[model samples]
Target: MPASAPLPKSARRPRPATDYDVVIIGAGSAGLSAALVLGRCLRRVLVCDGGAPRNEPSPAVWGFFTRDGVQPSELLRLGLEQLAAYPSVEVCSLRATEITASDQCFTIVADTEASRTRSITARKVLLATGVEDELPPLDGMREFWGHGVLHCPYCHGWEVRDRALAVYGRGKGVTGLALLVSRWSKNVVVCTDGPGGLTNKARQRLQKQGIAVREEPIERLEGTEKQGLQHVLFKNGDKLVREALFVHPHQHQHTNLAEQLGCRLNSKGAVWTDKKQQTSVPGLYAAGDTTAGMQQAILAAAEGSLAAIMINEKITKEECV
Candidate 1:
């Protein structure tokens, strides 16, 4: 971002010895986008490339405008490359382990790849840490992750369209999920692993929609990585060859920083923020999957950009005062 007109020396606040203007945890789409914006505004920024993103195992990211079908790693590489233009921004592979707040600034303790610990301080903090998916505990589930088993139909549905697909879940949510998956494939089955916990009308609706319900308990999934998932074995000794499976797994924050800092969380456990993305804690902000139920790369990036701009504005007002 182009810098605004320089403030008069009388009105300007001298730079303190604080390590950075902002310390951003988790350099995913959100952190990277925030760093880009803050760097352009000439604010010192540090983005921690903690580890692989939540979608690291995903083959490709979809529905992102102008970058559809791009590999997840490739998109991150491009983001990092473009951020190189901003001298005020720094990206490091550090795992932030602890955080504490004081009157002067917030302190952060991070561990390097070599396991060396480093302490840093910043005037502001942004938590871009995403969420973690709890995959169902079933044999071959890990092996077929991102390939045979998936989430987010808009993200991976087109690839498996017209193929034999199964929706894994039970109760109310599974009913709607199965109906949604039916849009991509004609052969859709709901594997409830026992009683489906559906109302009579709900089951009738599913049947009318041409979606089948499997009440047999699942034994395990059988598949090869090279050819993708081939079969789902049931405890009743019946087996069905399913090309792909979809499930909306339970999710939780990838890191506990938000809770550690006393940021109020919403009912879904995501850090609650105002429209400007500032968390309940002053000078602290959250963006991306850390702040909302809806998860998407493009949406996370937009949140990051908005947070950065809001942070800059807040800092400017402080300086003027």
Candidate 2:
């Protein structure tokens, strides 16, 4: 072993780093909420939002105390407006496309726009990029997604209460949803759109509960501006008139950054995190719909706040900056 030699002329030096205490991807409810807490703690934070939230189609977001009935857009506008007071937090209308984590800091590459880019480095990273609904490939389904065709009964049930409603799915999923929805509307029907796929016992239970099961293949959904769902037309030429339709849509992660970073996925196919919201990778965390918890704006915000607190405490233990 001899003394270290000088670097070769062709060797590339490390790139300049634009640093922050935390870089949050997805400025939706969860990311913004975490940014609020982290900013209040005086942590330098950057939030990159691609825009078009998972709930963008929803008319109003409910279940949040003191803020029910607020339009989803208005709710986020208010969040960004209030976050402006915190000088430590900077929100950007950019999409984070890539993430690289090392023992010290995580490097992020984000697309500001077409062919434009930005590089960011942070001591910690929070992924709040939620899931996207995989709506049924039926005509008119996408058009009425948020209002006419709904997901959570608790979210939209009251508005459509006592009206004719339909649940779109198969097997136990539709049955369970139909039963839950029956509480909202006595005229609840489960539309399997093909085969009902119910056990005899399940069918008996549904029959006992006064819920109808329709197994005909769906032709298409006909809708009108007055109501999101006008009717469910069947291939057999019979149609069921319904006021609204509910579904437990299949969902996928909005961003692949977690998988790119090798974060373990939970049984629900969401990012796996410890009770502290920390992911498998150290100094990296996740919250909101991205986690295993059921998706909700208020819940995501709370999870974001909790993740920020944990991040701040970890930083304090490591000698806060």
Model 1: lowest-lDDT 10 consecutive positions: 8-17
lDDT of 1: 0.89
What's each prediction's TM-score? 0.92, 0.92
- Please provide, for model 2 over 69-167, each residue's C-alpha lDDT reduced to its tens digit, 9 standing for 90 to 100: 899889889999999999999998888889998767899999986769988899999999999989999988998899889999888899899999999
lDDT at 74, model 1:
94
lDDT by residue for model 1 over 80-186, one digit each (tens)? 99999999999999999898887557889999999999999998999999998888888777778888899878788899999999999988889888888899999
Error of 2 at 232 (Å): 0.6
The true-versus-predicted C-alpha distance at residue 71 of model 2, in Å, is: 0.6
lDDT for residue 160 in candidate 2, whole number 0-100 = 94
Compared to the true structure, candidate 1 yields what TM-score?
0.92
